[model samples]
Target: MPRSLRARKLENAVGLAVIVALAIASVLPLIHILYMVIVRGVEAIARIGLYRFLTEPPHPFDPQNPGGIGPALVGSLELSGLAIAVATLIALPASVLIAEFRGSRISRGTLLLALTLVEFPTILVGLTVYAVLVDHVVGGYNMLAGAVALTLVILPYMAVQASEALRGVPEGVREAAYSLGATRLKTVYALIAPAARRGILVGILIGLARAAGETAPLLFTVGGAYEGYHLCLYKVGGAVPLMIYQFIQMPYKPAQDLAWGAALVLMTIIVGVMLLARLLVKEVKIL
Candidate 1:
């Protein structure tokens, strides 16, 4: 080979090697975390029995009794459900308005604010909600406060996704609706919104998945009730992430085990939701 050709080939090979190394380096930590959680969490669940582990609360100070994460699991579901409902209710209308009035100052301002908030620190949202709801209004931490905090954390994401989904509807569809004498509100609600339902549902699932795994937002708002299961919005509650955060720091074997199990469950939930969203996206593309 010519000398310059040889040098170019060597440089390309070196660049490829570097990219491979970076990719592996980034994926290694996630692999390690998944391995540890699976191994230890499975052992913990096996020791306690899966049924009991799913239906009981943790005994943090005890080393022999490996308790379940029932309370936290239920609380996570309730909080995610409530937060998603409220966020979707508010986001849908705002998203429609933005899509319909793309040139208006209000629409531009709302879209800009939502995009800006998509990357905001969630812990600050937690602190703000704690001060506003728990300190002044609710008088203490409760499920409602936690749900409100999560709603705030997930709202921007839901709004942005819904807006994009609405905009994805063909302009021809809007024109057709207008030519059919449909009112502006009717065209948006009856035609554009239904056409974009799948995308909106994907956003809701993604936001709910994000909310379900949030620990910092629930740290000061949910009150961490592990003694029993709670279903009321006005009551204190526990979440899988919150339990893992509290348990992993304790100086007990059982608590640590419980934390691993909780982490596994939470990871499964978040991953499942994301995969469902991916499937929906694929379906959309194939259509």
Candidate 2:
């Protein structure tokens, strides 16, 4: 081979080797963590009874006394669901508007502002929301406050992802729709939105996953409670992350084990969401 071609081949080999090594290094920790979580968590789940653990309050799982995490799971689902809904309601339209009107000064400013929001820390977002909604207005920590805080934390990221997805819609498609005499809104809704639906769905799924795993924002806004799982929105609810955090500091072995199980459950949930998102995207592409 010519000298230049030989040098190029060597460089490509080196790059491939580095990429493979880095991929393995990046995945090792996740693999180990998942392995440990599955082992320990499965043991706990089996001992406690998966149905019971999913439908009852956390209690000692000894022969004398058995308890489950039903309430915590319910609360987690409720809070996370609410947060995801609110965030998507705000972010999706904003993203579409921004993407469709990139040249407008207002849209440009709004995009910049959303970008800034993405960099804000979860703790600060929690504190700000708590102060505005809970302390100043509502006068107490509640589900609404927690949801608002989480929405703020997830919205900017979702918006940015959505904007990118919307922008990715082919210009040719838009022009064709316009040539067909479709209004801007109609074209966006009928063509661009459907074409980029997979990306938008993936972004929303990611946002949901982020909201589900958040703890710092929930700390101030959702304040944990051990009892009263069936309370109203104003009532405090215990979450798995907060529960794990609280339990990890205790002197009890059972609490420690429960914390590990909770961690495993949370990871399982986020991973499941991600897998579903991937499957959805794949299916959309296939169709």
Candidate 3:
């Protein structure tokens, strides 16, 4: 082989090694965290019994046992579902518009706006919801308010993710569609959206995962209940993150155990969603 070709190969090999090394370094902390949570939490849950730990309402500190976190589990699912639904409604349209008009001033502005909103603090989102819905519009803190707050928090994420997915569609595909006398809307719905569905789903799941784990936003909006489960959207709600936070702060051992268990459950949920995203990402290599 030529000396120049050998030199280029060596350079490429070095770059690949550096990338692999950095990737491993980045993943090390996450692996450590997952291991720690699983070890601590699994032990606690083993002693507690899986059924009671998952189904019953939390019990006050007892050296003998701590109760379940069913109410918080319900609230977290409901809030995250509602938030995903609402965010998807707004985000899909915005993303579609941006994809269609990639060079438009409005699209540029919208992209910038979404990027800005993604950086907005979760506390601020909660406060905004509290001010607008709790005190002013709805006259109370309810699941509705909590869901709305989460929607604001995840809207940008969905918008940007969907847009990137849409952008990944080959330009030639759009041109081909145009050649077939397809309208812009027809092209988007029939061709672009299908090609990007997996990516969009990934974003949706990620947004839901983040929203579910949010404690700060729920602090001001949900103000979780311990007495009983609240099912109505207009009623107060509790979430797993809030339950975990409250439990972990107690001076009681049982409560601490419950906290660990709850953390494990929450982490399991987020990790599950992430794994689903990874599956979709692998299946759809458009980007």
Candidate with best lDDT: 1
TM-score of candidate 1 on Cα atoms, chains taken together: 0.94
What's the lDDT for candidate 2?
A: 0.81
Instruction: For candidate 2, write residues 1-287 as lDDT tens digits.
Output: 46798899999999999999999999999899999888987776777777876776776334333456677778888887888888889998899988999899978988998889888889998899889978888787777777788889889988887888899888999999999999999999899988988888888888888888888998888777755574467767777787778777877766666777788889989999889888877532211
Candidate 3 C-alpha lDDT tens digits along 1-287: 56798889999999999999999999999999999899989988888688878878777577775777888888888899889999999999999988889899999999999888888888999998999988897777788999999999999989988998999999988999999999988999899988989889998988988988988888888777855788788878889998888878888888888788889999999889888888888752211
Residue-level lDDT for 59 in candidate 1? 83
Model 3: how far is 209 from its true place, Å? Answer: 1.3
Model 1, 140-166: lDDT tens per residue? Answer: 889999999999999988888888899
- Least lDDT summed over 10 consecutive residues: which range in candidate 1? 278-287
- Which candidate should be chosen as best, given TM-score against the real structure? 1
Candidate 1 vs candidate 3: which has greater lDDT? 1
Error of 1 at 50 (Å): 1.5
lDDT of candidates 1 onward, in order:
0.89, 0.81, 0.86
Output the lDDT of residue 131, model 2.
90
